[model samples]
Target: MEIILEKTTKPFFKKHAGSQALAKERIGAILEREQATGLTKVKLALRQPVAGRPCFELRCNLAKLGSVRVAFILDGQVARI
Candidate 1:
């Protein structure tokens, strides 16, 4: 399996100094977890404020599955499995 990370996702990972392997692992984990929940595809967005705030959004295929718009932050990293 393969996953494509959007351009918007890059900055977050870069900011965190995340390694490629770590990013791949995190993404793969999410994909596997989602698949176990009967979802074939998912879209995830992560945003972190310069002042140390974090937020995230997750969607399954185009339908909103989870929205943590301003509650939680995500480290930009993605994988597929």
Candidate 2:
């Protein structure tokens, strides 16, 4: 499996939550898991948008720096983050 970053909403998503790399890692984990589990495709709706389109939202728990929400898109061997 592979992931393709369509956009880096970090500059915008960071305004509210999570870091770019952190969010990407978390999402990547989930995506990888899904693929391993035989899940072909998935689309998690985020409260944000990418280029006027909906995005997949992710979350992180810093326990110190606080938490954040990441919005991205994922597809077969390619994803947008």
Candidate 3:
């Protein structure tokens, strides 16, 4: 089975410098753990919002890491879903 992980960047981070890079690193760490658990990095994206404000949503698939499904969002440096 495959699982998808999604993370949304908050409004504040969009205005802060280096937030995108930080988000990438933070998300990378999560992906690394998934890889260690036998999952493959299938797909990823940094989404743009349609209205209100702009945000990023990263989507990844974990087909090799059992049947567990996980999704999360990032608020600044915090991870939530």
User: By descending TM-score, how would the candidates be arranged?
Assistant: 2, 1, 3
Q: List the residue pairs that clash in candidate 3.
A: 73-80
* Superposed model 3: Cα runs more than 4 Å off: 1-18, 40-81
**lDDT at residue 25 of model 2 (Cα atoms):** 62
| Weakest ten-residue segment in model 3 by summed lDDT | 61-70
Evaluated at residue 15, the lDDT of candidate 3 is 56
The TM-score values for the models, in the order shown, are 0.41, 0.43, 0.29
> Backbone clashes in each candidate structure, one number apiece?
4, 5, 1
Q: Name the better of 1 and 2 by TM-score.
A: 2
- For model 2, what is the C-alpha lDDT against the true structure? 0.57
lDDT of 1 by residue, 27-76 (tens): 55555575577544433334435235333334322112222121123333
lDDT, candidate 1, equals: 0.42
Largest TM-score belongs to which candidate? 2
Write candidate 3's Cα lDDT for 10-61 as tens digits: 4434555454454445556665564466444433323553233333333533
Error of 2 at 78 (Å): 1.5
Leading candidate by lDDT: 2
lDDT (tens digit, per residue) of candidate 2 on 1-81: 354545455355557464555555666677677658764444567566656666665564434446555455555566665
Candidate 2 — which residues are off by over 4 angstroms? 7-11, 16-18, 40-75
